[model samples]
Target: QQQVKQSPQSLIVQKGGISIINCAYENTAFDYFPWYQQFPGKGPALLIAIRPDVSEKKEGRFTISFNKSAKQFSLHIMDSQPGDSATYFCAASYSTSGSRLTFGEGTQLTVNP
Candidate 1:
C-alpha cells in the first residue's frame, strides 16, 4: 500500500508566485513530518518540518501546513524563484522507525522567470 500520495506530479509557477504541493498519508503513527527538496544532480535536503502538535511551520520562503486529523499536509513556497525549481518530497516517520521515512511521490516544480 502506498502510505503517502502526492498530487500534481508536476507544477509550473512563475517567479514571485506561490507553489503548492499536497500530500496525504494513511498512517496515524507518524509524528515527524518533513519536506525535502532535491536538485537534479544532488541529494534531497531537508527544507522544513513540523510535528503533529502544530498546524503549520514556516522557514523563510518554505512553509509546511499540516492537518493531523485529516492525515494530510502540504508544502507552500512563497515568492517562488527560478532557483527554487526542484523536486519536492513529503515524508513522515515515527520515533520507533529511527531515521527511516515513508515518502510521497515527488512533485517536480519548475519556476519560470
Candidate 2:
C-alpha cells in the first residue's frame, strides 16, 4: 500500500516567517520524495524533492528535509509570503512506478501580511 500521512490539515504563517509541513510514509520502497504546491484553479506544481540518499534539499526559499531511517520528510518555506500561500502535498514514488505517485492528504498554508 502506498500512503503518506501528513500532519496539520491547515496552517497560517506571517509574512517573512517560516512555514513547515510534515509527512511520513509507511512504504520503504519509496525512493523519491517530492512536495507539490497547488494554487486555486490550477494544477499542482513541483516545489522541491529529495532522495533516500540525501538528507536534505533546498531550492530558493523552499527546502525538503528528509529522514531515511524514520521514513519521514518535511517541507520548509523560508520567508513565507502571501503569494506562497497554497495547498501543499507530499508524495512518494519509485522508479518502477513510473510517474505514479502516492500523495498525502494535503496541507493548506496561508501566509498573511
Candidate 3:
C-alpha cells in the first residue's frame, strides 16, 4: 500500500523564523516526490521535490530532504514570513502515473508578524 502521512497538521512561527514539517510513505513504487504550496483558494503549486534516487533538493527558500532507505522525506522552510503563510502538501507518485499525485493531508503554516 502506497500511502503518505504527514505530521504537525498546523504550524505557527514568527516572521523570519524557520518552519519544518515531516512526512513518511509506505510504498517503494513511488518514484516522484513533490512538495506543493497552496494558498487559501487555489490549486497547489510545486515547491520542491526529489526522486527516490536523490537525497535532497532545494529551490529558493524551500528544501526537500529525502531518505530513500527509510522511505521518508521532509520539507524545510527558511526565513519564514507572514507572506509565506499557506498550506503545504507533500506528495508522491510514480512517473509512470503521468504526474498523478498522492498527497499528504496537509500542513497549515501561520507566520505571525
* Alpha carbon lDDT at 46, candidate 2: 89
lDDT of each: 0.94, 0.94, 0.91
Tens-digit per-residue lDDT, 1-113, candidate 1:
99999988999999999999999999898999899999999999999999999999989988899998899999999999999999999999999988699999999999999
If ranked by TM-score, best first, what sequence of candidates would result? 1, 2, 3
Displacement of residue 101 (Cα, Å) in model 2 is 0.3
- Kindly report which residue stretches of model 2 are placed more than 4 angstroms away from their true locations once superposed: none
Better of 2 and 3 by TM-score: 2
lDDT of 2: 0.94
For candidate 2, write residues 27-107 as lDDT tens digits. 889999999999999999988889999998999999999999988999999999999999999999998888689999999
Which order, best to worst by lDDT?
1, 2, 3
Candidate 3 clashes between residue pairs 3 or more apart in a chain or in different chains: none
Tell me each candidate's TM-score.
0.97, 0.96, 0.93
